[model samples]
Target: MTAYKSREEVPLNEKWNLEDIYPNLQSWEEDFKKVGNMIDDVKKFDGAIHGANDLYSYLSLGEELGMVYKKLYVYAMLQVDLDTRVTASQALLDRASQLGQKLSAATAFFNPFLLSLEEKTLQSWIEEVQGLKYFEDDLYELYRYKAHVLSKEKEEVLSQMGEAFSAPRNTFGMINNADIKFGDVTNKDGEKVELTRGMYSKLIEDDNRDTRIEAYKAYYKPYVQLQNTIASTLSAAIKNNVLMAKMRNYPTALEKSLFGDMVPKEVYDNLIKATKENIEPMHRYMKLRKDILQLDELRAYDIAVPLVKDVKQEISFDDAYDTMLKSLAPLGEEYVSTLRSFKEKRYFDVRETPGKRSGAYNLGLYGVHPFILLNHQDDLDSLFTLTHECGHGMHSYLSSKHQPQISAGYSIFVAEVASTVNEILLIRYLLKETEDKHMKKHLLNHFIDSFKGTMFTQVMFSEFEKITHEKSEQGEPLNAEVFNTIYEQLFRVFNGDELVFDDEVKFGWSRIPHFYRPFYVYKYATGYASAIHIADKLLEGDSDTLERYLTFLKSGSSDYPLELLKATGVDLTTPEPIQNALSIFSELVNEFAEL
Candidate 1:
C-alpha cells in the first residue's frame, strides 16, 4: 500500500477543484465583503412584509443573500478542512460563521412578520405578485410554522441568542474531540499503537480479539473518568431542547425537532418498535460471529471483527471510481454520465494528508458543483465510502439543478437515502461480479455490518436519546449513574446475552457526539430502511421506478420528506420499510453463516 501523502505531495488532479468556487483568496475576500454588504442591505426590508411588492422584494433579496452566504460559508469551511492547522483558514471560517449568525438575526423578523399576515392575505400576495409566485413553496412552508413562530421581538431574541443556545453542543465538541485522549494500546505485533477516535472503527475490526479489547478499554478510560462532565453537558443539551420545545408549544423536544421536517412522531416510534421486533436477526448474527470465531464468550468488542478471514481486499482509487460508476448503472446512463463527469472534473479531494479532516462528506453549494472530501484508504470500506458520499454528491447535483435556490437543499430526514442507496447498489454489484467465495462472504459481511451500524445501532442510539429526553422532562437528573444505567440496559437489550459488556461500555455514550444533536441519529435508520426498499426496485431494472427515485432526489425541500419518499414508493410513515431492511439483514446473515 502507498504511504499517506501531504497536500503538497498529492497531484493536482487528485485534489478537489476548489478554484471553481473561488479563483483565489482575493476572490474569496471580495465575496466576504459582498456578504457583509448584503447583510446590511437585508435589514432595510425588515418591516417590509406588509405589501405584496415589499414581500416580493424581501423574499427575492433574502434568496440572493442566502445564495451568497452559502457560497461564502462553504468556501471558508472547505478551506479550513483542507488544512485545519492554518490560522488564517480558521479565522476565515470564524468570520464566515459570524456573518451567518448576523444574517440569521437580520432575517428573524421575516418569519414572525409572515406569521402575522393573515393566510388569506399571504395567498392573495402570492397570486398577485409575480416574484412572490416563485417562492410559493417557501411561503407555504413559513405559514406551516405559524403556530410555532413567536412574535417578532421574541423571534429576534431567539435568533440573536442562537450562539449562546448552542453552548452545550460546542462545549461537548471541545471536550470530546479536542480534550479527551484515548491513550494507546499494544497491537498484535507487540508495537504500541496510539488510539484516537478515528482509529476506533478500524481497531474494533482487528482480527485479534486481544487487540480489540485493549483498544476498547483504552479508548473508554478517559470517557469513564469524565463521565460526570459529559453527562452534565448532555443534560444541558437536553434542557436546551426541552426549553425550545416548550417555547414553540410543542409537547416534546422530539416533536419540536421532527416538526420542521414534517416528520410525525409515529415515524420515530415505529422505527424503534420495528427494530425491537426484528432484534432476533441481529442476535442470531451475533451468535454466528461467536461460533465462527470459536470464542468461548463474545464481548462487545468482538462484534466488529469479520467472521470470514483472509478476505481483506485493497482497492485502488482508480478502481474504486470505475466500480462506483459501474455500480450506479441501475440509475441509467444520464446518472452514470453525470457522476463520471464529476470524476473527470476532479470533484473529489481523494487522499488523506497532514492536517486534513478525517471522514468523508459531500459539500454542496447552490451554484457550483459539489465537492467531496475523503481520507481514502485502499480497502473495500473506503471504496464503499466513496460510493456513499458520491451518492450524496449526485443527490446534491440533481437537486441544485432542478430546484430553486430556496428549496434546493434537502432536509436531514431524507439526506441519507441517496447515499445508502448507492452503498446497497455497490454491494450488489460487487457480489454479482466476485466469484471468490471469501470475497463474496466478505461482501455479505459488509452488507450485514452496514445494516448493523446504520439501522440497528442508530436505532439503539435513537432509543437512548428518547429515553434520556423523557427522563429529563420528568425531572430526573441525568448524572453519570443514571446515564450509564440507561445506556447499559439499552446495550444489553440490543445485543442480547450473546455479547459481554465490560464496565467501560457504560461510557460509550460519552464518546458519541451525535447525542449533542438530539434526535438526529434516527434518520440514519429511516434513511437506510428507505434506501433498501428503493435499491431493490431500481435493481429490478424497472424504468418507472428509476425515474421516480430520480424525481424524489430532485424534489429537494419543495415537499415534506415523507411525501417526497412516498412519491419514490418508500413510505416511512409505516414500519414496512424497516421490516424489509431487517429481512434483508437476516437473509445476508443466513448467507454469511452458510459460507
Candidate 2:
C-alpha cells in the first residue's frame, strides 16, 4: 500500500475547486461583510411582517440572506476541514459560526410572530401577496409546529442555551479524538502499527484473525478505561434532550427528535421489529463466515475479515469514476452527464493528505455547486464511497435547481436514501460484470457486510439509545455499570448465542459518538431500507420509477419526508420496506452460501 499524500503533493485537479465558492480570502471576506450587514436589514422587518407587503418582502429578503449565509458558512467549513491545523481557517470557521448565531438571534421572532397570526389572516395575506405563494409550504411547515413554538422570550432563552447544550458532544469528541490513546499493536507482518479509529476498520478487515483480534483489543482498551467518563457525558446529553423535549411539550425525547424531521415513531419501531425478525439470516451469515474462515468459534473481531482471500483488487480513481457513471446509468443520460461534469469541474477533493478530515461527505451550499471531501484509498470501498458522496451531490444539485433557497435542504430522515441507492446500484453492476467465483463471493460479502453495518448495527444502536433514554427518564442511575449491562444484553439479543464477545464489547456504547445525537442512528437503518426498495425498482427497468425517484430528489423539504418517500413509492411509515430489504439480505446470504 502507498503512503498517504500531502495536500501540496496531490495533483491540482484532484482537489476540490474552492475557487468556485470564492476566488480568494478577500472575496470570501467581502461576502462575509455583506452577510453581516444583511442581518441588520433582516431585523428591520421583524415587527413589520404582519402586513401583506411586509410579509412578501420579509420572505424574499430572508431567502436571499439565507443563500448568502450558506455560501459563507460552507466555504469556511470546507476550508477548515481541508487542514484543521490552520489557525486562519479555524478563525474563519468561528466567524461564520458567530455570524450564524447573530442571524438566528436577529430573526428569532419570525416563527413565533408568524404562528401568532390567525390562520384566516395568514391565508388572506398569502392570497393578497402573489409572491407569498412561493413561500406557502415554508409558512405551513412552521405552522405545523405552532403547538410547540414557545413565547419569543422563552425561545430566545433556548436559542442562547444552544452552545451550552453542545458541551457534552464537544467534550466527547475531545476525549475520543484527541485525548484517548489506543496505543500500538504489532500486525501479522511483525510491524508495529498505531491503532486509531480509522485504522480499526482496516485492521479488523485483515485476513489474519490474530491481527484483527489484537487490533480490536488495542483499539477498544481506552474506551473501556474511560467508560465512566464517557457514560457521564452521554447521560448529560440524554438529559439535555429530555429537558428540551419537555420544554417543547413533547412526550418523549425520541418523539421530539423525530418530530423535527417529520418522521413518525412507527418508522423507528418498525425498523427494530424488522431487524429482530431477520436475525436468522444474520445468524446464517455468521455461520457461513465461521465455516469459510475455518474458525472454531466466531468472535466479533472475526466478522469483518473477508471470506475470500487474495481476491482484493485495487481500483484507480479514474476507473472508480467510470464504474460509478456506468452503474448509475439507470438514472438516465442527463443525470450521468451532470455527474461527469462534476468530475471534470473538480468538485471533489479526492486524496488523503496530512491534517485532512477522515471519512467522506458532500457539502451542499445554496448558491454554489456541492463540494465533496474524500480520502480516496483506491479500493472497492473507496469506489463505493465516491459513488455515495456523488449521490448526495446529485441530490443537492437537483434540489437547489428546482426549489427556492428556503426549501432546498432535505431532511436527514431521507438524506441517506440517495447515497445508499447509489451503493446498491454499483454493487449490482459489479456483481453482473465479475466472472470469478472468488470475486463474486467477495462482492456478496461486501453487500452482506453493508447490510449488517448499516441496517443491523445501526438499529442495534438505536435500540440501545431508546432503552437508555427511557431508563434515564424513569430516573434510573445512568452510570457505567447501568450502561454496560443494557448494552451487553442488547448485544446478546442481536448477535445471538452463535457469537462470543470479549469483556471490552460491553464498553462499546462509550465509543459510539452518535449517542450524543439522540435517536439519529435509526435513520441510517430506515434510509438503507428505503434505498434498497427504490434501487430494486429502478434496476428492474421501471422508467417511471426512475422519474419518480428524480422528482423525490428535487422535492427537498417542500413536503414531509414521509410524503416525499411515498411519492417515490416507498412508504417508510409501514413495515414493508424494512421487511423487503431484509428479504433481499436473506437472498444474498443464500447466494454467498452457494458460492
Query: Model-by-model lDDT, in order?
Result: 0.87, 0.87
lDDT of candidate 1? 0.87
Estimate, for each residue in 442-480, the C-alpha lDDT of model 2 and write its tens digit.
999999998998999999999999999898788788889
Model 1 Cα lDDT, one tens digit per residue, 143-195? 88877999888988898888888888978876764567678788667888677
TM-scores, all candidates, are 0.96, 0.96
Estimate the overall C-alpha local distance difference test score of candidate 2: 0.87
Candidate 2 Cα outliers beyond 4 Å, as residue runs: 187-189
**Distance from true location, Cα of 307 in model 2, Å:** 0.9
Report RMSD (Å) for each prediction in the order shown: 1.8, 1.8
Backbone clashes under 3 angstroms, per model: 0, 0
Clashing pairs in 2: none
